[model samples]
Target: MTGSTGDFAGRRIVITGGARGLGAAFVTALAEAGARVCFGDVLHDAGAALAQQLAVQGHDVGYLPLDLARPESVSAFVEAASQRMGGIDGLVNNAAITNSGGRLAGELPVQTWDAVLDVNVRGTWLMCVAAQRWLRESGRGAIVNIASDTALWGAPRLLAYVASKGAVIAMTHSLAREFGAEDITVNAIAPGLTEVEATAYVPGDRHAYYLEGRALRRPQTPADVTGPVLFLLSGAARFVTGQLLPVNGGFVMN
Candidate 1:
């Protein structure tokens, strides 16, 4: 847990869907490490509360209302974050949407697919595009995209969510090559069955299936994934790009 001389000190970081779940964990960890974090989320009440709580702790954390379903909102949030934090050095594309209910593909509505794709894929892409310009200008920047292990192993009954995460994995690789020459390492973390508020929608059997394969036989927390995220966004992972590191508890060993 010993960070390198506050490696993120004076750095500006932007995280999407950072009000709760794993996204909030990243914000807290980075802010504690001395990074000025500007986060956006659709959950206004939670976002505002988290920001106020962190500010009380003397952390430079700012929250903005953002709806990832709209590309314009994503762009505007990034723009405002860049302006607010001075400049962008890192971005954590963690915003996503799951189906309202545990509906399988055969019974899932097209709207469910559209909703998931809009936020997980399109929103992530737009955020990266908006942040890319500033990251390039900074000359030292990194990106850590949040993907899911379900995408890699294929989760049943959650087709839309899995598909969107699969798209995120593909996007991360493509962007890594596009921004490699600029010295910006683009990578992803594919967490497996992490215990977060977001997983409340996951079916009980599905969760059991995920746990059965873990060597550790324990549920993963946001803290388990935060280390890999910070590593990717730190100087330590400069040479590591176009890689998807799994933060699962040995659930899906690839």
Candidate 2:
């Protein structure tokens, strides 16, 4: 869509994990579309560099250090973003952790599950809660949680990651219902085996398998998912809520 047609002009957006990967792509895209972007991430160097680059390019982009696993850190990050951006017009819960234990659900250790859930599920919940309060007061907001295709189609070895993303999907629906009354839209995007540094650990065979069934016959990239995300957060999707839009290159039909 043209910049004038895009709904993000003069809007304020907050993105977690915005230092790199898909989060970085989102920040760049949103800023280019005229959204004032504030992002929080633990990668201090990368975050600072990206923020500086965007600023040099004449984009309203800010970066803050955040640790999603800590409630205090989450609160501080949200508060600072809200204060700096003059309240949030959109929130993207994109920060997550993937456990590399590679165990079956029954064989997974308690600590492994806790570690993944702490950052992926609990962190997302906290961010949403904090943003909801501000959105309620502002009377208009949009949230787009980053889910995974594995949440819909189970992954054998990544049990913890799958479970965490599944919970995110469920939470999106529940929050959408609760926040709808306050004029806030809540939804999720489930990407399938997107090309990112995090996916470097993915088995080559599994990557090939994911690509084999796609009609496009190619691995997905960060740019592949950004369009759908921009749509969901825009005025074009005002009536769309409580939905999970999968940007997985048709890897899984559902």
Candidate 3:
């Protein structure tokens, strides 16, 4: 896609986990692309501040507090965001938690497993279900679920996180089939190890591995994943659904 695509102009989009990291980038990029965007996150202060900053630039952006682990909040967030946006057209499921990485499956506590599944898998599903009505009303709705390349390559010591992402990919396929009749496209974007605030604790050697091992031989950034996401949300990808697009610089080819 070029800089001139009008796919986002006058559109309304809702993003989760938009307070920081990759989600923050999505809020900025989509709003700048001419979409009236409302983002939700657990970080009330940061999310509000981002919305304020974007509004100062005359961008149509709003923020709300959302807790993905709480199932009831999904429908509530969508209803509120749609009211703020006057309607809804797209959803980006980016909220997730890994809860202190680097633990074997046996060492990982039950709470860790539950929390990961509740937020990463169940949360994404509920959000989609809640937003489907608004999306159907919009007549050209789309969804982009953020997944991880770790699920594809079976990265070690992240059992819960990887499993949750794999579930997301599977749900994408099934949901795409269900929503196809409504012409609402559902897709997943699996990104590699990206340089973001959420990844600050990653070991230096791990970062080095990603940079050297990928075909691009460089680190992936928040911006690096935006183009593919925007394309999926755009009119250009209207016919593209139930597919997983990897934006990891050729790191996990399937």
Candidate 4:
């Protein structure tokens, strides 16, 4: 999926947590595909740098500060992005946290659990609500929620993160049904433990588990997941919604 494809030419898109890792990859891919993109992240500097870098490459991409934990921030980001792009045609809910990991479920603090849910579940919901109107108005809107394979595999010591992703998957189903009337498609991609900065905190054993368990032996990279995302947001998937596509090298076959 290079810039030459231009499948998303003239499209207006928004992405969350795009300062680095998978979000950054998504931003680059989408922009190269000729989409006018607006991406946000709590990492203000990184977000700004990424936007500038892409801009230098002749891509129409903007960066805004967004903390999904704050409803006001979510609302403001959406409004600003919409105003900047004239409207939104696609949304990628890619921001999430896994602070609850590396601890026993019973040892998880209430604050930690609450924080995870606030950003992962509640944040995702707010993004959808805020972008609803613009997406509908586009008449070709698509949403791609970033979920995790851990939710489906029941990864131990990551209860809160797992639960939050499960909610995202469930939300995809309901959102698809409701947005269907508006000609919007909502779907999810549950990626495996890919090699990204966000997952650097994960234990080596967990990484090994994923590598050893996959039908494909090679370690997963950000590029491995971007193609499916592009397809879902493209015209080819106009009729495909309420679906969960796992890009984990067949680690957990559905």
lDDT tens digits, residue span 1-254, model 4: 22232469889999999999999999999999899999999999999999999999999999999999999999999999999999999999999999998899999999999999999999999999999999999988999999999999999999999999999999999999999999999999999998999999998999899999999998999999999998888888888999999999999999
Model 3: pairs clashing at backbone N, Cα or C within 3 Å: none
Give the C-alpha miss distance for residue 178 in model 1, angstroms.
Answer: 0.7
Output the TM-score of candidate 3. 0.97
Better of 2 and 3 by TM-score: 3
- Give the lDDT of residue 154 in candidate 2: 86
What's model 1's lDDT at 222? 90
Off by over 4 Å in 4: 1-6
TM-score of each: 0.96, 0.96, 0.97, 0.98
After TM-score superposition, what is the CA distance of residue 200 in candidate 2 from its true location, in Å?
A: 0.9
Residue pairs clashing in model 2 are none
Worst 10 residues of 3 by lDDT: 1-10
Q: Which stretches of candidate 3 lie above 4 Å from their native place?
A: 1-4
| Every candidate's lDDT | 0.89, 0.91, 0.92, 0.95
Sort order, lDDT high to low: 4, 3, 2, 1
Q: Say which candidate scores most in lDDT.
A: 4
Tens digits of per-residue lDDT, candidate 1, 113-194, equal 8998998999988888899888998877889999999898887777998999999999999999999988888999999888
Candidate 1, superposed: residue stretches over 4 Å from native: 1-6
- The C-alpha RMSD in Å for every predicted model, in order, reads 2.0, 1.9, 1.8, 2.2
In terms of lDDT, which candidate is stronger, 3 or 4? 4
